[model samples]
Target: MKLYLRFMGIHFRSSMEYKASFFMLGIATMIASLGGLLSLTFLFMRFHTIAGYTFSQVLLCFSTIVMSFALSEVFFRGFDRFEQIIRGGTFDRMLLRPCSLIGQILFEKIEFNRLSKVIEAAVVLAYAIPRSGVIWTADKILVLILMILGGVMMFAGMFLLFAGICFYTLEGLEVLNILTNGSENFGHYPVSVYGKWMLRFYTFIVPLACVQYYPLQYLLGRSDRSWYGLLPLAGFVFTIPCYCFWRIGLKHYKSNGS
Candidate 1:
C-alpha cells in the first residue's frame, strides 16, 4: 500500500504540472455529470414519481451508481486504457519489474480529473440522503457502504473484462461501453423502473441490481427482507470470472517487443 501511495503521489505531481488543463477537464467532467442530474430533475417535474419512486429516492440511486463508477474510473483507468499501454510496450517494461502485474497496472495512472464526477455524486448524495426519508440505522448504514463497495468492484470487474478483451483484439472495443457507461446512464433510476426483463437482466446477468436495487429496497424500508441488505455482496462474485478471463488473456498476450 505504501508503494501504491508513492505511485499516487508521483501521478499527482505529474498531473499538477498541467494545472490549468487538469482543472478545465475536471470542470468539464463535473458539468457533464450534472447533465444527467438535470435530466432527472426535468423528468420528475413532468411526473410526481417514477415507477412509484420519489425524486429523492431516485436521486439516491443515481448518486450511488455514479459514485461507484467515478471511483472505478479514478482507480482502474489503467485497465480502461490498457490497449495503449500494451501498444506502447509499457506492458513489456512492467513485466521486467519484480512487482505484481495487476498492481503495476492499477498504479500506472491515477486520474485526478475524474474526481469531479465523484464530487458531483457526493453533492447529490448529501442532498438525497436526508430527503429520501430513510430511517437510518447502523445496519442500513453498513449496507449502504457495502453497496458502494460492491458497485465499485463490479465496475472494476467490467474494466478488467474490457482489458482482457484487448489482449486478444489488440485494440479497445467501443461496444463495451454498453456495459460500463451505458449501465451508469441507465442506472440513474431503480432497475425495476425499466420493466421486468431489464430488471432481471441487471440482476442475473450484470448483477447491477444486486448492488443498487435489492439493497436499496432494504435501505429505504420498502422490504422486510433483512437479507436484501447483504445482496450487494453477491456482486463481488462477478470479479472472479473477470479475473479468470484476465489470466486467460495474459497467456495469449503478444508483446509489442519494444
Candidate 2:
C-alpha cells in the first residue's frame, strides 16, 4: 500500500506540473457533462416521468451511477486503460518491482481530471436529495450508499476485465467502452425504462439492475419486500469473474514472454 501511494504521488506530481492542461481537460469534461444535465432537465420537462419513475427518482439513479463511475475512473482508471501499458511494455516495469503487479498497475496513473464528474454528481445529488422528498430513513440511505459502492465495484470489475482481455485480443479497446462507459451513459435513466432485453442484460449479466434498479425500487417504496433493498450486494458477483479473468491474463502474458 505504501508503494502504491508513492507511485500515485509521482503520478499526481506529474499531473501537477502541467496545471493548465489539467484544468483545461477538467473544464472541458465538466462542460460536456453539463450538457448531459441540461438534457436530463429537459427530459423532465417533457414527460414529467418515465415508466412510473419520477424526475427526482431518475436523477437519483443518474447521480448515484455518475458518482460511482467518476470515482472509479478517477482512481481505478489505471486498469481502464491498461492496454497501453501492456502494448508499450510499461507493464514490464512492474514485474521488475518487488510489489504486486496489481498494486503497481493500480498506482500507475490517477486522473484527478475525472473528479469533474464527481463534483457534478455531488451537486446533482445534493439538489435531488431534498427535492426528491423521500421519508429519509436509515434503511433507505443505507440502500442508496450500498448501491453506489456496489455499482462502483461492478463497473471497476468490468474495466479490469476489459484490461485483462487485452492480454488475449491486444485490440478492441473501444469495444470495451461499450460495457463500461456505455453502461454509465445508459444508467442516467431507470434501467426498467429500457427494453426487456436490456434489463435482463444489466441484471443477470452486468448486475447493474441489481445495484441500481432494485435498490431504487426499495428506496422509492415501490418494493414490497426488504430483500429488494439488499439486492445490490449481488453486484459483487461481477468482481469474482473479473478477477479470475485478470489472473488468467496475467499468466498468459507471462507465458508469451514478449
Candidate 3:
C-alpha cells in the first residue's frame, strides 16, 4: 500500500508539471463525453423513453457506466496499453523486479485526465438521483455504490484479459475494445434493452448485467429480489479468471524468452 501511494504521488507530480496541457486534455475528454450525453438528450426529447426506462433512469445508468469506465481507464490503462511495454522490452525489465508484476504494471501509468469523465458522471448522477424514481434507502445507496465499484472491477478485468492476449499477439487487439469501450457505450441504457441473447452473454459471460441491470431493477423497484443487490459481487469474481489468464500469459512469456 505504501509503495502504491509512492507511485501515485510521483505520477501526480509528473502530471502537475504541465498544468495547462493536462487541464486542456482533461477538458477535451470531458467535452468528448458530452457528445454522448447530448445524443441521449436529443433522443429523449423526441421520445420520452427508451423501451420502458425513463430518461432519468437511463441517465442513472449512463452515469454509473461512465464513472466506472473513467475510473478503470485512470487506473488500468497501463494494462490496456500493455503491448507497448512488451514491445519496448520494459515488461522484461519488470519481470526482473521482486515486486508483483500486476502492481508494477498498474503503477506504470495513472491517467488523471480521465477524472474529467468522473466529474461529469457525478454531475449527471446528482441530477439523476431524485428524478430517477428510485426510492432511496440504506440498502439502495449501498447497492448504488457497489454498482460503480463492481463496474470498475469488470472493466479492469476486461483490460487484464486484453493484456493477457498481448502475450501471443504482441499487439493490442481492436476486437477487445468491443468488450471494454463498447460495453460502456451500450450500458447507457439498461442491458435488457440490448436483447435477450446479448443480455445473457453480458450476464453469464462478461457479468456486465450483474453490475448494472439486476441491481438497477431492485433500485427502481421493478423487482423485489434482495439478492439482486448482491449480484455486483459477481463482477469481482470475474477478475479471478482474468487474472489466471494473465498469469498463464506470463508463464508463456517466460518460456518463450520474450
Instruction: Give each model a TM-score.
Output: 0.98, 0.94, 0.97
Where does the lowest 10-residue lDDT sum fall in candidate 1?
249-258
For model 3 the local lDDT of residue 33 reads 91
- Please provide, for model 2 over 60-134, each residue's C-alpha lDDT reduced to its tens digit, 9 standing for 90 to 100: 999999988888888788887787788778888778888778777788778989888889999999988887767
Point out where model 3 deviates above 4 Å: 254-258
Candidate 1's residue-wise lDDT over 1-258, tens digit each? Answer: 899999999999999999999999999999998899999999999997998899999999999999999999999999999999888889989989999999999998899999999999999999999999999888888998898889999999999999999999888999999999988999899999999999999998898999999998999888999899998887688999999999999999888566
Clashing pairs in 2: none
Model 1 TM-score relative to the real fold: 0.98
Full-model lDDT for every candidate: 0.93, 0.85, 0.93
Look at candidate 1 and tell me the lDDT of residue 150: 93
Q: Residue 134: error of model 2 in Å? A: 1.4
Sort the candidates on TM-score, descending order: 1, 3, 2
Candidate 3 matches the true fold with a TM-score of 0.97
Of models 2 and 3, which has the larger lDDT? 3
Instruction: Please write out the lDDT profile of model 3 over residues 141-170, one tens digit for every residue.
Output: 999999999999999999999999999888
What lDDT is reached at residue 154 by model 1? Answer: 93
Q: Model 1 scores what on Cα lDDT?
A: 0.93
